[model samples]
Target: MIQDLRGANACDADGCDRALTEPQLVFETDAGRREAYECPCGAVTITVARPESSR
Candidate 1:
C-alpha cells in the first residue's frame, strides 16, 4: 500500500471500502490539491495538506 503520510479518510459516508485506481486530476486551489479515484463501490476524496512553511 502507498504510505501517504498525508491525512486521509479512505471511505465514503456509508463506511465502504473503495477499489482505488490511479488517481485522476480533478482540480486544485490555494488551500490544497484535489484528486479523484475510481472505485467499484464508490468514490474516494483525498486532500493533501500544504507544507507548514508554505502556509
Candidate 2:
C-alpha cells in the first residue's frame, strides 16, 4: 500500500521551479520506508527512512 506522510514544502530537484506542499507517495519495504517526491521537470526524488531499531 502507498501512503502520504506529509511535510513537504517544495521540490528538492535542481533547476526545478515547482511549488508543492503535499506529502509524497510512501512505500514500506523490508529495508525501510520510501518517500517519492515528484517534480515539475519530470524528476522524482526518493528518500528512505529506516527504522531506528535496525540502525
* Index of the highest-lDDT prediction: 2
Q: Looking at candidate 1, what is the lDDT of residue 28?
A: 62
State the lDDT of candidate 2 residue by residue for 1-55, as single tens digits.
Answer: 2233244355556877575544357788778887777766777767678876898
Give model 2's TM-score versus the native structure.
0.56
Q: After superposition, how far is residue 4 of candidate 1 from its true place, in Å?
A: 2.5
* Number of the predicted model whose TM-score against the real structure is largest: 2
Error of 2 at 9 (Å): 7.4
- Candidate 1, residue 50: how far the Cα is off, in Å: 2.5
Estimate candidate 2's alpha-carbon lDDT, on a 0 to 1 scale: 0.63
**2 in model 1: Cα distance from truth in Å?**
8.6
Model 2 superposed RMSD (Cα): 4.8
